[model samples]
Target: MTRKLLHTALVLSLFLPGCRLENLSADQLDLITNSVSSTFKAARPISDEEEYYVGRAVAAKILTSYRLVNNRKLTDYVNLVGQAVAIHSEKPFTFGGYHFAILDSGEINAFACPGGIIFITRGMLDAVSNEDELAAVLAHEVGHINHRDGIGAISQARWTEALTTIGSQAAKTYGSKDVAKLVGLFEGSIDDVFKTLVVNGYGRSQEHAADLASLNYLAATGYDPHALKTFLDRLVARSGGSQGGIMKTHPATRDRVDNVAANMPEQKSDAAHFSERSRRFASILGK
Candidate 1:
């Protein structure tokens, strides 16, 4: 699918709230019709390119609520660590490549957009003590992308209906009314993913699988797998009966801590590497 189609979907969802399609100029209608017609197809397994486009749309929806951090150095550092862990995952490359960004919110959360864009919140970064912990977090997010959890969050029924609508509408004339319907469907699919990410959260099994994946990636990349346990322990200790952000979105921290502890691999610590990475982490994001 084209970026133009993705952009048009986002623009229409955000700007056209209740406006009737008839109010638009002929040019605008043509743009909408053409964009929609170019994008969708009969429901099937989503392609990598389509996954990348969907991820971008979800990321755009997320940015509407949270501002991205503007610090280039910090952003670059995060990408460095993220890429380090991402390379070891099952699906190392995506159609759009991997990107990492920090969000300027103090919500203890991280979101993995469908393809490879990962957003770690300022609060989550603060919660991490060093590079290993940060790597642990990024690895966990990469696991979600590897597993296609974000794309899986979309409702199958809704997606099928959306594709069917496009297929049926494509045969005849693609009119403004058809465009509006498809746009609404597209917006609904986005909402399904958005709600799963921000509101309802992934299921326990998905979180468990991601945690296991994170441990594997961390060990493969030379970060202590137990770093994930340490981070989860901190979350458990600080939860204080609260339910918000990560605490709300992920499986219970206590359960995750136990799982990590149970499955943690045996690895020798490299003092020199740890010291160097810790120092670098502190340089960018103070202790």
Candidate 2:
């Protein structure tokens, strides 16, 4: 028997009440040991720290394709708006905290990395009419993070293999070959997330769930939840069957708008609040 298996058996023997290690056949011992390991493997979920690392790598990969906005004022404004909504999300905090950035691309797209990194494109910012709309956008992305939609994109088989490798003695020893294998698995995971966020987009169910979550976050943060519906309405009107950027990656705009309207909270209007946020939004992004 392997040293790890033997160690597991010995540990189990000590803890198992009235169970004698010597009484069990070698086959029975091996079966028990394998069952314990399998149980642990099945129960393990990716840690927040691991998700943060994956998010960072995915962010880096995205940056390679789209340059970051060079204007500090614009960057800071986006972060401020993003954090305002994020603080009211289901997950108010993350392992690395939330970081929001703007991509210089004119594509109307946004991406939520696995942990707490969110990216919105210049076109998307322009698409929003006011700060509340921007908050709606950010809230939607935050929903993805709260639900772990990005991490869910990773193939189950790949994740299972990675967990098995991680639990092995070779991984513990950090042998060069094993280290390289781990790196390859990590890269595969990044690819899966990047593709989901940028290329294929999330499934319709995920998009709908995120929209519903966005409404909740917006209402909780004192932003108008109707802003989300309005944004989708604009998308549907502007899209006209065009398949690019967000239209390409997200579900049909009309469907999302319908979902939002169906689940919308009671309407609340504050003209003074609207004007103040609109002024702030225009000062930075323009009307």
Clash counts for all predictions: 0, 0
Error of 2 at 221 (Å): 0.7
- Relative to the unseen true structure, what is the Cα RMSD of model 1? 8.8
Collision count of model 2: 0
In candidate 2, position 237 carries an lDDT of 90
lDDT of 1: 0.83
Clashing pairs in 1: none
Report the error of model 2 at residue 100, Å: 0.7
Please state the error at residue 206 of candidate 1 in Å.
0.5
Please write out the lDDT profile of model 2 over residues 1-287, one tens digit for every residue: 77656755654544454556676667655545554454354346889998999999999999999999898999999999899999998899999999999999999999999999999999999899999999999999999999999998874756567656645632122345654675576568788899999999998899999999999998888899999999899898989889889998875577778899999988696889999989999888867
Where's the lowest-lDDT run of ten residues in candidate 2?
Answer: 166-175
lDDT scores of the candidates, listed in order: 0.83, 0.83
Q: Could you give me the TM-score of model 2 versus the true structure?
A: 0.80
Cα deviation at 55, candidate 1, in Å, is 0.6
Q: Name the runs in model 2 displaced over 4 angstroms.
A: 1-3, 6-43, 155-157, 160-186
